[model samples]
Target: MRVSSIYVDGYRRLTSQKINFEDGTTILAGANNSGKTSLIDLLRVVLGGDGNLRAEDLSASARFDWLMSLVDAAIEGEDCFRALLEDENVFEKVPSVVVRIEVGYDPDTDDIRQFADYLMDLDSEKSSFYFEFRFSSKRDGMIAAFSGLYSDIRKAVDDCNWRSANDAEPGSSVFLVLQAKVDAALVNCSKPEVFFSDESYSNVLPMSTDKSFKRLFNFRAVKASRALDDTSDDKSGELNQRLIAVAKEDKNWEGVISKLPSRVVEAIHDLDIRKLTTDETLRSLNTVIESISSTNGAKQNDLFLDFHVTEDHAVQMIARAMQTRYLGAGVPLSEASQGLGYSNLIFLHLEAESFIRSAAQEENRYLVNLVVLEEPESHMHPQMQSAFIKHLLSRVNEIGCLQAAVTTHSSEIVRLSGIEQLRVLKSEEAGCRIVDLRKFHTEEIADKPAETQRLFSFLYAINFSDLLFADRVIMYEGDTERMYFQALIKAHEELAGLRAQYISYIHVGGAYAHIYKPLVVDTLRLKTVIITDLDYEKESNLSSFEKLKPLLSTNATLNEFFQDGKKNSPPSVADLSSAISADTGVALVPDTELAAVAFQMQPEGYARTLEEAILATLLDAPVWTSLTKKKWKTFRNESGLKFSIPREPESPTITQIVASTSNQKTDFMYSLILNSNLVEAVPPYILSALRWLDS
Candidate 1:
């Protein structure tokens, strides 16, 4: 789930404003003094936030005063919404600030409809939605004067079907039968994640490790900053060492190392391959912690990787590493840089991913359902910041985490992201005016590579692209898997929704499956359906598949591919060609059967053969151009590069067929034209592959 929209009313600098959220990563943008902070506050409060400020309280009017100071003076002098209160003097000028946020979920996987169904049942099926919000004052002074203001609005939304399509309420229903028109506009905003404001967020829990959860084996990072900041009085480094020492808690490194699948781990990946080069990486972290704890009073300066370890020299480094501006070149712990590193979006991704993964392993993944990041772009290079945002959005599926809303000042960041996910904030005549970027402009920017590729092709490619098919995308690693998936779907219509017709199945090549998988999972911010096999066609290829089998599936083993086939399980291209009577461009090894051939040449051959086979099977050319290289080359230059041509007009004997287009220079027509007999004989797997590619 992702925040689709946010609406603010009667709270901060101005009046009522509603902002829609984007589906993927979003960048919140506004100039300074544009009520950016108030927008943040409104989001925090309305989305199940605990704050001391209440709208009805006279003493709580100071926040409004701040708003007035930023806005007009007449509004501050009058009390329109707060006429009966002590701060009523400024109330007339202060318009009511109501914040509304819309949330979106994967349509295929959304449970909001279920929640809506449950709510509809509660209302005697009269309505699919209801209103519910708590408006208690955060502070005692504000609480004392706070009337039943919260209940009033709840009652209004409950009874009032008066919501315009534009005016979405917090408690909008989902039941189709009751106010279905209005219900369609009402978004499915449910539980979202909350995060600290900054490293200095005293508003909630400090990210410090708690002893209560120690038994859960919290995967604590031994950070360099902690070491740099560790003094005699402050011992985060010592704490980390205690946490990581392995031997201190009636345990030792020896035992821990012994328990690990060291040989297997080494076989899987080299330490050098995974080594952290930058101070920002997690690999160099443990070393920093060790260095910090070893010293009597190592300051932030002593902990920075630049000061201690170089790329070539960091071989001795260990643990989580993050660089802070305060810990830059040299600085003591007490006055050390605190916010610079943790304030970054990169840090958020690392920690949040870590937390989510750990929780998933423990089957408590719901803890990561909501993630709140405040000002993730703080001090980051714009590219790095955008990269961090992309990573975060993509992680939505890896951990099953729900919502992520980040604040940003860079329009470049916003422009780089999808419009569906953005909520632009601005201070208007009222408080903060929120604009759902997806709705704001007919013309919008698509910064993503895939979208850019699509747009480029649309503008210049002379053809439409696959992205035009759906609102969502499902990625595939290669043509074979793509084919298999499509074939399965075609074979069984129940799974047709998983087909490449609507879903974009990118075949980034087999070698890239591992890299492509995470990249797809991360960038799309959605969970992936990885179904691959070590089921190679030949025995020799088994070793090649084994090289990547570890990355393919956790359960993959040597015997896993054995289908107990008494004979050849997967046929080769030659066999497939015979089966379907389809000449799949390339010739297969002599005796290989259909499935093997399909697996090897299915993806490319299908397209190469299918298009030519269907278009026309033969191309006519003069004998001089056809046989002589010099004449043919000249003719090729004059005749345009359109090599796509027809095959033979009719089935010919081998001698006749081979006589034509047998030479390399003359094979264009042969390459273009596919043999129908071959196509007719192509195996089902290869056929499926062809259909998927063409589709």
Candidate 2:
């Protein structure tokens, strides 16, 4: 239903290229001279356009002459052309225009094939068009079928004989013809239809330009009707009379009369000019008739009327002019007048929106169909441009039109829009290359559309526009309680407000935080400390976070931590090999270990005693109680006690379990923290840092 994709082949500053479109809103962005116009021109050509891009269709002499303007005709030989085409050291002059594409759709139809129903899904390998810059499949089957036939013919030329072309299969041409018929059933071969809101349309309409209202006079007028066989003006006039007589059946001059100003209405009732002797009387009569004719017979040539604005109306006109003049636009958005630097931008945008809206139907109004705006947002304001983009996007609902392939170099626009639909148009090789955003994939947190887009763009700086990482990031909790509790801890502790400026916290979007973690870890190297409720894993002896291993394996040290430990729920921490108990009743040391103990005790679990284990790991008591006045609950919550390495909390958190209260709980917390091989991993300073530095 929308302009789903675009294809460009062998065009200026562009090589063969193809772009796939998203179902909803899509934006195409790039740097200056990055081939934006090349993209637009390619679209124009593929849509059967003329003018600048129509250069390819010119005669050989014309092509050569034009080429000579930019280069010495001698150097513009086959080698130069070859270098251009191969884009290596020379250009190659290929016989055909070269851009390829695949369009996606929802309700597939013949006129424009919805992208979803392609003959070969883009993933199919047999189609060189999948990765090659040679195939261009438009939603319009006419373009696709014709291109397919051309490709087939080219294959045949390379194969055996002309008649043996792959497209020459029985009835293939006929099938294509039928498909063409289906495509034409509703849509046209010219530019696709675009819909817009009334406000969007009025912005572009230059009605206010002609204060005399004579421009509307220049519009299509109805003088008289012509009959197919009539020859004389008289006969034509008679026929026109007949036409009007017939049309009068539905005409409502009375309605127009009612809509006129009351003074005009009264003047109409007294148009017997003989009773009006003064200049004012004549003026009133003229004004009334003008108003009547303007409203009525609007389609007739004689119906065009002029208006005289009095001082009273000047205020309204001036107000409107000021608003339009001052309107602002850009990324770091502001008001149009002061913030915007260019003039006429607002008007130009209004014009384009109107043009698009006029052709749009009520149902298809939202879809941003193909926009042909020519640098409309160029002037007026930078902030206005940014605001314009957000305003445009915020209003774009599904019912809105498809994508906008704009020609822009506004950095603000690029930043605000992210880069999902960002297509980099580049002139390379003999032709242009379009880097379709859909073609880019990233390792950043792909779970979020915005995040994925942001990270994709971020990584692209170090990488591509594919947002693999962002300079700024926000972390959300799957549970709101965790955010609340984490906030509580921050408020009570040393890191208060510090974590916020560097790393922001957020509430989870929904019940299941099934966001793709692989994507997050791959790009950002996020140190996520998931404070999940210790729910039992379906499989016992495994940790509740078992799903997190392969993802965590990227970190060697963290990998070792989970690997050496037993699989567990809250109970698993106690199951670890290092902890010991004084007797069966209690395993002392730290409150951080309480959650795991509670799980074990509630399940009627008890630790296995080992007298050798006592010698196995030495003991201590109440060493943590000496420093700060703190309840076990407050201490555990504010400064969480994970089996932190003895080091200060730098890359990984550190928690040093003191000797237990009764020499028992000491072993419990210890078992969770120390790895047997890395027992010496705990540094001396690390042990001291684990002591409450400020508390």
Candidate 3:
């Protein structure tokens, strides 16, 4: 049976919190001091702890207030306060911690069910059972207290709705419902002095140090700091020591050691120098022993310094190196380059796995095999972090019927391990809060509306796992925009901080950018900024272009494009560009009524596209002239030095010049930022969007 969930209360910051687990690997991720370590410690205590709860395990914030108040109330000798003391008496519950675990078993797995039944005292009818273990100073007293109230307990037991306890089986009720209630009521009693004897706790069953319950549950924890620390050959290396002990204990090693030759007693007898050199000192002692002896046997015995041989002292490592080359060229494990430390730790885990597999080969295969890891990504770079988790998990599963759980703060761990396996802990005013990402995903979307499911499906197909690493996200349209935006953001000092934050720029394009709204806003709960063009598909009013072309056509430098018959009639650029240039002219119109209808066919109205948005930003006459001449030099001018556009800017003249030289809007924006004075000319909406995302 697997531990489906852990309910920890009255221990450190884990004041009444439940963390759920899956059969496979579950990743615990959270900020520092959010009780990630506390939860791991609680698991170690409840599942495999050796003794009763310690005083230091009491909640830090609640300890001082509780003890001081208890002292005050006892000194004052207030009976009423004692009567209502269950809610306030901190010392009574200070050393008391409760860990309740829900053991889940599959119906097909009879062995697991039988194992759970053996540990939890559950019948076959119960597919799942919660074993509540209370570790406290009053543990032994509580059992005695319940026996004292057995008459009242029997009456309550008869009155209890037995059907409620056996809801699954209807008629089977073998569990002690009476004892459970008596245990609860006595512990919940106001006066601890009257209810419980003043005694230190003796180890309790299932949660105690005894191996009786290990047939069902076992835990192995790899600490978070293991990655940075080197594995020593001394006593400080716990993992190393554990594996070495296991190797020494194996029957194969025992059999092999038994075959080795040893010195016979006859051969050692020849070296009895004690008899040859100590005759003077032993003569008087032998005479006294002969007179005082009561034994009938005539043999005499003398004490002397003795020595025996042991495998550890006899066998030694003459040479050791990691063979990494084809012909056995070696490097010492301690001095190996690349990811040797991480690789070595994984090797130790594999050795531990060998011991576990050996245990499974015996009759204890029903026992839970668990591997608990804390921050396995410590010294790992991003790539190594991803590779290590993948390999660790794959190897963990290779050992039959094993479960793994990892606690990490690495974004690579969160992303590569799969979002569904995440168990997020948040420290709140109430207590430590745990969110099982798997449970939330399953429950929230199982019966969602069809439209909502469709959006979820789209997101699932693309996978937002990568975005889990980003602090904030920028959603833009197409490849060209992504390219230029990166360059633009890098060029500007105001937006440069985004690189450090790992701000992700996602190219969802115009049509699909809105599809991510629910994912960003609801699911992932990320801070996101969407930059898309307000696009329209109608033709520009040729009259607006027609009106401005001739007026500016008189200038000799712009004659090729804007000169009446010489230029293309519909405008050389696309319809959206044509509409934006026309709209700029319309904004200059004296009457508001005429200007409104002038660009009516534009898709997103005024400034409907990126080209339109940038064009609408008023630029200095000199800046505009310089940008147009540069665009011509880059895209149209043959000799690279030749300029076909004018060197001076007029409102309509600059508009026509830009429309002639620039084909794509992204190209135009890139050229504009690079050549012109962009600080005074970037559109307010664009800058505001960037600033808001940065904030």
Candidate 4:
């Protein structure tokens, strides 16, 4: 049976969360120290047969924080402890870690047709039965049953004229009687073997046995840091012990030992060690001991190591040191470069696959395997990471009743795998949220798998980790805008707190800025502003401007500012409004609108780009001179056009030169910012947007 979903409550960093598992594979991804490890470890702790929350599992800082919380609760009153017993919230909860696994029934059980009938006729809530288990700090379940007995004992105390103890149910001798009963139950309790079902439920019944549960659930964990000590003596020794156990179970070793060219097995068995242990060997040894004792004038004593065949037929069989030599290099594997790392990682996976396959065989039917891997791409290059993840997935598909969960930060692995396989773990103040991309897709685009693949391909090529964790994001046009914004933010002291808010500035090209609307604004649910330039191939056609006018007019908010008569006479100042789409959290704003708020150089204008807006705001003669001089020295000199520039640096000529440079204005902007000590004023529109984002 496979696990459909896991509901965890009061596990470290996981207050209350339900993480759904997709068939085949599920990847948990997040930033460092963001609780991805904790979530994975907790899953192993729950469904894993011997999983438990021990003190050593927690970090030092977490332990200290937990202690301080308890201190505060104690100072508050007894009500605080009682709240913990109730487990209503994170603070009040004891180790009330409850895990419920929704199990999917196997088809091979009972008759396939009968099972299908049973499933169809079962209750909606009862169809998918939950295997639930919980952890509590104190004995809780049996207390209700024993409370009546305690009350009776308290009343007996009152009748016996023990007035002082009679007033206190707890202080009376009743607790002694309770302890005796508990001890007696522990010593002699035996669970009864019986089955019960409601007569009304003819088609279906819920049943579980310890043997069946054990056979159907298994968990194995391979941590990223585990490869470092794979070749340790203790580990190899354990392998030897396991090998011996296998030999004893099936006598498979006899077949391997029989392959010797000569009679090696016969020669070894011909030692006659059994005959050497007879009474004659003992007498010979005793006579020699007596002769030595007579010569030394001392009494003889019997002290010797004994060798005897035990009742269980066990023999002492020791394995020699493990030696591995590289075939190509003819060198010891440990001495080869990165050989230890590769050997440990590769062999562990091989062993895991072997174990899984063996467990699923006919003789070992009903065994279910859950393999957990942490950073399978560790110490591997990009190509190897891609190959390993692909191979792992393929291998898992070939095995039956096997499920795997991997935690990774490798974007290459993510790209090689499908986007539908990702489960993003985003840490927040409340707790970590696990977002499955399959569940996060918008309803309108749910059926379009090709479009989803296209989007994943585009996002994979770019480094967009910042966007996944940001509170809000501004989507600008290109690198030029991005560079200037980065520099401007450094100089503006009023925008200091903005850095703490985790704001991201992305360079989404003008034509495709709206494509990211569903991802950043819909899936992530972040407030987003699109800063796009008005492009009219030529000022005469006005194709883009005409298209945008109608789209903006469709929104009630935008209609008030840029619809009807206002369209013909477009606002010279910045044009800002909410998007005309159904999503309310996103806004489609023009570069002109932002420029007007940042600088007063424009009234209402068209085709005014970001660079033109910045230049218009920095109208000072020296600032212009510095910018132009840098441009000529860096870019113009390479083009051999520096000699044509006038010494005075006039506005009309300089403006033409600045606008006519290469397509990318990076060299000029980088040189201008470095050469001049002047602080560029934060554009009014940019400042207004930042303020709005903060609010």
Where is model 1 poorest over a 10-residue stretch in terms of lDDT?
182-191
Per-residue lDDT of candidate 2, residues 426-501 (tens digit): 4333444555544445323345588656744454343232222122223222342333334333443333443343
Name the runs in model 2 displaced over 4 angstroms.
42-104, 108-345, 348-356, 359-368, 372-377, 380-382, 429-431, 442-695
Models, CA RMSD each:
24.6, 22.1, 15.6, 10.7
Kindly indicate the candidate among 1 and 4 with the higher TM-score.
4
lDDT of 3: 0.52
Candidate number with greatest TM-score: 4
TM-score of each: 0.32, 0.33, 0.59, 0.63
Assess the local accuracy of residue 360 in candidate 4 as a C-alpha lDDT between 0 and 100. 63
Q: Per-residue lDDT of 87-149 in model 4, one digit per residue for the tens?
A: 545423223455556656544451223123223334544434355544443335323322223
As for lDDT, the candidate ahead, 2 or 4, is 4
The worst-scoring run of ten residues by lDDT in candidate 4 lies at 595-604
Better-scoring candidate (lDDT), 1 or 4: 4
